[model samples]
Target: MKLHVFDTFAYSKTGKILHFDVLLSERNEVKAHQRAIEWLDSIGEQGATIKPRGCTFCHTVADAPQFADEVARNGYAIYKLEGCPA
Candidate 1:
C-alpha cells in the first residue's frame, strides 16, 4: 500500500513542541491534520492544535507491513519523530 505522509508539529500544554508524521492511505490534507490533532489528544495533549505551518505534505511512500495493520484499523498511522512522551 502507498501512504501519504504529512509532517506535523504541535505544542503541548507545557509548551513543549511535538514533532511527528501522520501517514494515511489516501492523500487528504484535511484528514491528515485531523489525525494529527487526534493523536495529540490521545497522548494527553488535549485541545492541542497543529501550527499553521506545521502540517505539510512531505512525500508518499510504500507502506511498511507493521504500519498496514494500524492504517487499516485507524485510517492513519503516526510515526513519532521527536518531543513525544515515551
Candidate 2:
C-alpha cells in the first residue's frame, strides 16, 4: 500500500503553467496513482482552468520532486500543476 501526496507549485516564468508534485510511499503506490488520476479528472470535468494533465494541487508542489519522483520511478506519471485561471 503505497501512499502518494500531491502538492502544487507555480513556475518562475510569467503565464507559465502551474505545476504539482505527487508524492508516493511504497505501501500506497497503487491507490495513490489511481486517486491522483481521479483527482485530475475531477478538476478537469469542472472545466477547471487547467486540464487534468495540466492542473495540480498545492500539496503536490509543497513537498516537491522528491515527493513525487519516487512514485514516477515506479510507474505513476507526474501531472504539472496549473492554477485555476481567473
Candidate 3:
C-alpha cells in the first residue's frame, strides 16, 4: 500500500492537518471508503483534520475524480509519514 505524501510544512501552513493518520483497508474499494469515513469521524473527535482528497491540498492528483477515488487507489493515507525517508 502506497499513500501519496503530504507536505507537513504545507499542512502546517494550510492548517489542514491536525494529526497524522495511516489507514489500511481491504482491497475492496467500497470497504476502503467506508473505513476512510470512519477514520475521519473517529479522528475528528480528537481534532484531526483529514479529508479524502478534496479538502484543500490535492494538487498532486488533481485529475482524480474525488478523494474517495484517491483512497481506493491505495490502502494508506494520502499523505506520507512526517519523518520517514520516502
Could you estimate the TM-score for every candidate?
A: 0.93, 0.29, 0.29
Question: In order, what is each prediction's RMSD in angstroms?
Answer: 1.0, 10.2, 9.6
Which digits, one per residue and each the tens of the lDDT, describe model 3 over residues 1-86?
Answer: 33332322213233654333333323334443444445455544333334454232222432334445555765445343442224
Model 1 worst lDDT run, 10 consecutive residues: 47-56
Candidate number with greatest TM-score: 1
Taking the tens digit of each residue's C-alpha lDDT, what string does model 2 give over 1-86?
A: 34445453333334444455555553343455465555455555222233343323233233445435545665554445455332
In candidate 3, where is summed lDDT lowest over 10 consecutive residues?
4-13
What tens-digit string does per-residue lDDT give for candidate 1 at 31-70?
Answer: 9999998898898899776878798889999857878889
> What's the ranking of the predictions by TM-score, best on top?
1, 2, 3
Rank candidates, lDDT, best first. 1, 2, 3
Which one wins on lDDT? 1
Which candidate, 1 or 2, would have the higher TM-score against the true structure? 1
lDDT against the true structure, per candidate, is 0.89, 0.44, 0.38
Q: What is the lDDT of candidate 3?
A: 0.38
Model 1: CA > 4 A from native: none
